[model samples]
Target: MTLTLEERVRLFGSPIPEGFTVRVVESGTVINDEIVSDTKVVANGYDLYMTDKVFETMRDKCLSKTSKVWGEAKS
Candidate 1:
């Protein structure tokens, strides 16, 4: 199903209750050394996964300054 940007944002950005955090994982990555994987956010007793396309787009657009800083810090 094709969702509008507003809908997508609403669906993905809704806040979880206190004492919970979102877990984001990329597709095709292993968790605990297992091949089969699912990417989702678990928070406040809820589990959610953004669509693959959305996840990829967001990941690609995210700033890497933190990673660059970490690399520089390590050097």
Candidate 2:
């Protein structure tokens, strides 16, 4: 089964705060070359009405960028 953004965030030891919402900007891949476990998510509100500055501020405080590039980076 596919995991939600909250579950994936918990995998990294950072859970988003209450009243904050996020959506997947780019779905993660499970391929050989790029094994991105966590998707690219943005701090958009529940109805996608959050402003950029507020979203960015919350994202910076709550989330982190996840990447798992193989070969040179994944060694």
Candidate 3:
């Protein structure tokens, strides 16, 4: 079954705020794209957007960034 963005965020602590609506999309990059989880975060119809590079960097650093703040919401 497919889950919505909010569900995913709720089930797994979000690195981004859930106060606003967000949409995730695949970022098609030419270089080694197959090995990378390229994603873009779009909020409120592109009013705010995170590039794939920025997204990936943030994702890679998320655990460290929010670990203390969110306090590990996993089992």
Off by over 4 Å in 3: 1-12, 22-47, 64-75
Candidate 3 pairs with clashing backbones = none
- Per-residue CA lDDT of model 1 for 1-75, tens digit only, reads 875444443455323333444455555544444432344432224533444554555554332332342343312
- Position 5, candidate 1: lDDT: 42
Stretches off by above 4 angstroms in model 2 are: 1-46, 64-75
RMSD of each: 10.6, 15.3, 10.8
Top candidate on lDDT is 3
Clashing pairs in 1: none
Cα lDDT tens digits, model 3, 4-71, are 44445556676455565433345542332232234544444333354557666666665554554466
Single out the weakest 10-residue window by summed lDDT for candidate 1. 35-44
What TM-score do all the candidates reach, one by one? 0.25, 0.25, 0.33
Candidate 1 stretches with Cα past 4 Å from truth are 1-44, 63-75
Please list the C-alpha lDDT of all candidates, in the order they appear.
0.41, 0.41, 0.49
Q: Which scores higher on TM-score, 2 or 3? A: 3
| TM-score, cand. 2 | 0.25
